[model samples]
Target: MTKFLLRWIASAASIYITAALFENVYITGFDAAMLAAVILGIANMIVKPIIVLFTLPINIVTLGLFTLVINGFVLKITAGLVSGFMINGLFTAILASVVLSIVHVVLSGILGVKKD
Candidate 1:
């Protein structure tokens, strides 16, 4: 469970960084950020896959670009679920999702967490 905790911490850091860099991505504080990260991760793992599966044809039609929209939807849902985590708008959520994805990837690499 050490790796899981490490990844969770990395995700929280990514959320914090994304909030810092984007005006529309608002994280109230460190505790909020951590909770948001967990909520986002759970949403991504559960809701995101179902959404992506349903939107697969559209995803293929859009040459995989719709995945970003799926990610944004998950982020928006996360914001709605978490009281202190707020995304100003859909567009901002999309941008923040993209940034978060990048940050997560970098953190995973740095932390030596293999992507499977």
Candidate 2:
């Protein structure tokens, strides 16, 4: 539970970074960014597994690259759920997803999660 919260915060940090660094992404405020993170965490927790299972066949066929699409979907969903998060385009969402992946990896690395 605690670990999950930490990862969620890290994910939001990455989101905030993308908003700060990238022109296309827009977050209204830091609070909005944090809320977006929590929303994303919930979506990943409750929604992503179902999506992964539903897409399992293609995932295997694509060697798991479908996950990028899934991740972007999650971000898109997050945007709709929260008022402050506005992902301008598919490309921006994709870029945000990459930033998210990097942040998750780095934090997970520091926390000593074994990488696959």
- The C-alpha lDDT values of all candidates are 0.90, 0.82
lDDT of 1: 0.90
Error of 1 at 109 (Å): 2.3
TM per candidate: 0.93, 0.80
lDDT by residue (tens digit), candidate 1, 1-116:
88888888889989989999998888889899789988988898899999999999999999999999989989999999998899999989999999999998999889987655
Error of 2 at 22 (Å): 2.1
TM-score of candidate 2 versus the correct structure, residues matched by position: 0.80
- Give every collision pair in model 2: none
Give lDDT: candidate 2, residue 30. 77
